[model samples]
Target: MGHADTLLAMGGAFLAAAFFARLGNRIGLPTIPLFTLAGMLLGPHTPGFVLVEDAHDFEMLSALGLVLLLFYLGLEFHLDDLKTGGRRLALAGGSYLLLNVGAGFGFGLALDWGIREALVLAGVLGISSSAIVTKILIDLGRLGRPETRLILGVIVVEDVFLALYLAALQPVIGGAHGVAEVLFQVTKAFAFLLVLAATARYGTRLIGRLIHVRDDELLVISFLGAAVLVAGVSELLGVADAIGAFMVGLILAQTPSAARIRRLVHPLRDAFAAIFFFAFGLAIDPGDFAAVLVPVAVAATLTLLMNVAAGLIVARLYGYGPGPAADIAATLLARGEFALILAAMAATAGLDERLAPFIAGYVLVLAVLGPVAAGRAHLVVRRLTGGRTPDGPDDLAPVEAPERTTSA
Candidate 1:
């Protein structure tokens, strides 16, 4: 197709996604899943007028969306919060990761898949979609809530674990025989992350001086260029671009320019994020999902229960009330990009073709349902327990809405 045609198609898709988001808002629902549903309907595999013919192009835009999304999340999150959370945060995050990974691994083994395939499934099912989580937090105005900090901290821990897991898995699965080669690859991954941490800790002032400008335009350009540059370098060094982008935001978060940087990047992030969700939907073929639907549904149900168990454990450790705990559980139920990436890697490495479609289906169902569940968690719990909130004796009192802070 011509450039004009491509641009028009992309533009139309964006508008449609926005419309769907608005529609979801009117219907008292989350927007991300709606956008993804819109993409599925307009996708090539579905019987409809496909707006995006070349998924590759939309994929690029989607990648940018992820970078911006993670970057924005980092701006909101802080290492200090995790530090202050201390042992509770560590225990909560660690236990949650262990439970999910264990569940996925056991599920794979139960299905009689080999160890390697089980490891792949474990990675897919274990990590929550940070993009989806961040959006829900912002949309619901829950970012500043106490439990939200724990949630973000746990997510950061999960991302770090995922990086290390992928690094080690790639070498092992690729048949790097020697202990030295595997150690070398794992060391490289940690070293890269260590450098990012150091920079975030010590180099913030330098970055501030270099990129902080009175001119908003120059500041935006400078910050954006740095984020993109770091992301590209991270990709070259065998880390995910979103991690690099997030590290940049972490460093900037320490500086005085964080609010401005956030303001400048907000529109870009939202715009590209919509495209990303749509592009994600575009790649999914409805036919491919059918064969794996039953197994995927069963696995998803198991994980959902596991997620609730994990969330409650973490919430109790951190001293959250039942209401907040339920919110954490519902939010953590989502699985997306990271899972999709692992599934794709499994396919690329020929570890398992069946893994990808099952993952696609599973993630689709949960990602859509998770946000809705989170938004209505209080109501669900109330209804389940005979129309009373879960806060012990106070359950009889009318459940008040959570206080939404002005800060994103």
Candidate 2:
């Protein structure tokens, strides 16, 4: 496409996303699905008004969206929160992973796909989309709620698990025979995580000094450079780039400039994040959904059940009531970027042909459902629990509805 055409397409995509999101807002729906729906309708895969011939055109911007979303999450997260709830977070995260991943593995095996394909599906079905979760939290204005802290902690644990999971699965999918190669991959991934963790824990002062400046423009440039550079290195070192960006934010969170950085990054994060979801929809071909309908339905149902179970378990551990438990379940129910990543790996490795469509359908289902469920979780909990409200001082009762535009 010519430069003018590219501009027009990009402009049209933004406008369509805004229009759909505005409609969702009027009906009290979440923006994540609406933005995605806009892209799906306009994308080349669907009929009429193709916004872009290739979804790859938005790849870079979408990636930036993911990075910024996680980066802001890390910024909001603090060392003190981890210190106070370390053990609880560990247990909660562990229980969540055990239930979801174990069930997902069994479900994959039940599909009669190959062992390699099952392994891929295990990760795909297990991990929640950090990007979507972050957006929901922000949209619902639930950041101040006590359960939100636990949710973010769980996300951190999942990122760590993902690093090891990918390491173990890579050699299997790549047809590597050497035990040494497997050990090396695991060790390298673990080491990189440790290094970043240690930096977040101990090196804040130096990092703060490096990125600190008098001018907002220069400071923005410095922090953005740091985030993107570390994210690139993390990807090269066999870790997710989002984790790297998150780590950078974590490190900067301890600095004097933390609040300023957050202020500067919010607009960029919102714009890019809208693009991220839109681009995701663009890549999906609606025509393929029929091929994987049954499995997708079953998998999505299983995921909902397991997530709710895990949420109840975590709430019990934290001494929270059904309201918080429902919030936990609904918030973490969506699957996105990670599942797509695994599907791509499966396709590249020539695993089961059905894996891609299955994941695509599954993600699309939950991406819409997850946010809607989260929005109404309190009502669900109230109805189920005989009108007993959330118990904690920081429950969802205090979470005000965010402004309409904030959803994007």
Cα lDDT of model 1 by residue, 1-408, tens digit: 688988897889889998998997787555666777787788787886978766676767777887887677667666576565566667888899999999998988987767778888888778888767876788788776667766777876776576567756765555455889767765776688789889888888887788778999998888888888988887666566677787888788888898898888988888887787787677667787777878898888988888899978987775556777888889888887677656645654577566766876788788778888888998977777778665433333322122211121
State the lDDT at 157 in candidate 1: 74
lDDT of candidate 2 over 84-105, digit per residue (tens): 5567677888899999999899
**lDDT score at residue 257, model 2, on the 0-100 scale:** 96
Q: How many angstroms is residue 136 displaced in model 1 relative to the true structure, after the best TM-score fit?
A: 5.2
Residue range with the least summed lDDT across 10 consecutive positions in model 2? 398-407
TM-score against native, each model: 0.83, 0.81
- The superposed Cα distance between candidate 1 and the true structure at residue 356, in angstroms, equals 4.1
Give lDDT per model, in order: 0.75, 0.78
Per-model clash counts, in order, read: 0, 0
Best candidate per TM-score, number?
1
